[model samples]
Target: MIEPAARPRATAAWLLLALLAAAAYLLGLGGQHIPKNGDESVYMHIARLTAGTGQWLPLQSEIEGLARNTKPPLLFWQAMVAGSWGEAWSLWRLRLPSYLYTLASALLVGALAARLVARPGANDAPRPPLQVAALAVLVYLAFFSTYRYSRPYLTSAPETFWMFAPFFAIAWSPARVLGSRLGFPLLAGVALGIACLYKSFALVLPVALALGACYQVAGPRGRGLFVLRRAGFWSDVGRVLLAAIVATALFALWFVVDPAPAEVWREFVVGENAGKFNARESYLGKALAGSGSIWGLIPGYAVNAGLLMPVVVGLLFAAWRARSGADASERVLWLWLLVLLLVFMLPSQRSARYLVAAMPALAVLMVLHWPRIARGWFIATLLMALLATLFALNVALGVQALEPSAGGYSAGLWLWLLAMAAACVAGLVKDGWTRPVAALISAAFYVAFAWVTAPLEGPAGRYDDAVIERLRGEAVMVPSNFNGDFERYQFLLPGARIEHYFAAQPVDFDGLPALLAGHRFVIVQRRVGQPPCADERAEACRVVAARWDIRSRQTNAEIRASLLRAPQDFWFAREYLVERLAAAEGRP
Candidate 1:
């Protein structure tokens, strides 16, 4: 977003750095502590189970109440192909598609942003297309929502790419869709349908709404607010309708292809899609109150930007100030964003994630208004990244100290952290460097997070090879606080019949082993310093192997203690793979 103070080479370097950092951000994506929803493992569980069946129809799931049709089959298929149909199943393999999809979308965003700015309307002064385009890619990748959901075997990346593609095309050249009645509409419909197949059918509404808005204010009618002529308006409406119908028809393929069409209708179309309408007591009341309120959702655009939230605030101000002067193309981007927001506002289950598809448009808008935005926003972003950098280093230190066996942080890893610290400092000081630094800072934090958890993928994070082989074809009870969280064991201890125990339940350290009775081999958790077998005579358990884990969902007190005092005590825990010597084969 910054005009190069000197040479374009520096800008190119920053772009390359941002791209590499983006890749590095997802380095340990499959680990336990990445920022993601519980749905990830659930989706993975379904995909793995479905992959085992070797048939595409009727998406599989072990999660009760939300069987076969919890989500569309496409995401499962994606995970299946990525994981090699359960033969080479690993969290990283399952999540690779998500990373690729996100990267593709970011590339499209950069090219579109450069195109939008290169034209006469968006920029205040002439800037190189390459510079603006590279910065846009960095900005899109820097988004917190993109960082959180764009990887980790989730549908966010594919849905974002497919759903936003049509808009990107329209914004790139309005005449393509608006010029031909059926050509663009049909193609756009196919794209939206695929997106719906990845995510949910409910998304079709927003896609349709955004497409309608884009067409209404595009071409000859773009300069003014309305189409004015009755025939022209009807023509546009018909085109939008055709697109929506096509998208819905593609979604209907699920019902047609699946063996149990009736179940797909009931479980997915009714339960998943229609169930969102089951609102609270009063629609307006709920809209005005609670965490799900319309007010909370209003600033979703900024919220999605995470550390770059301030930059978005500046973008909003800049857009408002230049509202009167903005061109049709710029306004089209605005309409797509606004329409998505308003359409999703109607749903009972409103989340910022619903607006992620429109994020590429947001990235374009950010690039167009970048020069006008305040430098203070960049400073704010650098400060946040600086804080995250410290956390990364501190946690890495803690993790390293805990595991002397896992080769301590490599030189390359240490250098990466050092570079992050340096970038944060430079961004805060020099205004010229701030934009590029802000762009890569989020990815830096992602890398830091990955580094902190990277050891988990090593010996310290996994059981001994011999122990893993011993557990194969045997029952292994693991801790699961959420639906499908135990799916992690599929990769951690493969070929084992894994069952879940409520590890989140309050621990009775004295009787922890007794609590895991009836299973031959059980994975039990205890505080880092707490003894795994405090009551040895109880036949509670015999620790066969152990691994380190940064306990998830720590209390606020624990978090503060982690930073202020001993990191191991409050943040880390030990998971023991113990043998229950005297218990029968009971299940919880």
Candidate 2:
């Protein structure tokens, strides 16, 4: 335990460390290498549309007749506000809010951990609460999912923060509320309401389950019977209900304010919410079918938690050992984890990102129970770390050997692996400090790993300013049959008017010539061994431009041919041809 006088200094040290961690996370955040994923493109499109139209209510999308109210308007509003920062919208500007949200969430994790550690009846032999809290923040930022999805223009980071914030507020409150102040409950309600506005009303499930578990363990109980006869218990229940009502009211404000209330109801409530659950062809349904069972989430959860899995397993074992003597906080933590897992499992569309809300509780529980974990568990965790470090080193060296040019990039990874291996060995050799040492090392390795791999987004490609400049005022046509590639092109070609034709349909091929006559440029896909143009009718479409290959290695004809021969074995290189149709046809 840290003395009260020393606590301030310890906290300051931890804050400095946390700030450093934040900087690592934010390194190259706005780099051009960070390509926009499909989700980011959709959100960016909607945000741009909102910014252009100035429609605060009944959120709209770039796609005509499509409403963007499937999720709440908060993220779009945030993106719109971020986009307004400069004259031109950029990826960094759009993703700024998510970065801030992620930082705030990390800080909140530390605060929550500190609060849980400071509670009465916490483990006597535990490390200082500040140390534990700092470790929790480190563990969270080190998570692979946190590195991947947290900084993107996504709802996971903000949603996780909002969901956990209310629990922290209520759980950290004084043991008893004697007056009618309703402070904690009101704070919880407001947080929950904002979360709902950020994403969906489904957030109510996890919050309710967590609060109920808190009540079960903390509320007064009679001998051999669970009773809620006390005034405080009833007051707590009423406050929770009030919170729910407040959230509902906030959620309903969209319908009342939107000029097209019917559109909001039909699109959001019926189409987005109910439709997702009912339609077997929806994304959720397809995921459930593809996964084979709900248990598919187990592996995903492990991967998302990253290096913390060993600690999680150890914590579980400790909880099982102390099940009979578990305190209110322990019960709440366990219930929170179980409830989050179960609720997410119920959804057809399950993702590791969805489980992020449970990470803070898991971090706190791991810290609270670290002192009780067996030596064997720590040894096993160390062994796992060692194996992981060795594997990373092998892969990095192998890649360097295969491609001499990649040696520069792989050197950093090799160094990180070496450092991780040393840390693991030190932890194994040390006594009474194995867990803390291992945790700190693991955190450092993950941070380094995220930093080294941040440049990997290069392969995903970005908007080519040269391409856009060349075809500034021209209309471009592309095949509508392909997947999300068109959407990406649409986003990149902001100034050019892009139209699509059903090239896959034989009946539409007859009209291809007429379509080409009207458009100056036509973007078409060309597979290896096939003619550059789709058919002889497209002979007038002479290739004038090609898609940019953003990968590290320059692709050649041999590689393209091989990928085309085994399309199922690999994602074939997509070479788009930008043809000047009118010029080829010798038209003025």
> Lowest-lDDT window of 10 residues in candidate 1?
505-514
Query: For residues 334-453, what per-residue lDDT tens digits would candidate 1 score against the true structure?
Result: 988998899888878779987888888899899999988888988988888878777777777777777586437778778888899899899888978887778778877777677767
Q: Write the per-residue lDDT of candidate 2 for residues 176-290, one digit (tens) a residue.
A: 5212247766677778888888888878777776665566566443112444654456655676677777777787777778788888778887777665454555655555566
- lDDT of prediction 2: 0.63
Specify the highest-TM-score model's number.
1
Query: How many residue pairs clash in model 2?
Result: 0
Report the Cα lDDT for candidate 1: 0.80
Alpha-carbon lDDT, every model: 0.80, 0.63
In angstroms, give how far residue 212 of model 2 lies from its true place. 3.1
Q: What lDDT score goes with residue 488 in model 2?
A: 44
Task: Please report the TM-score between candidate 2 and the true structure.
Answer: 0.77
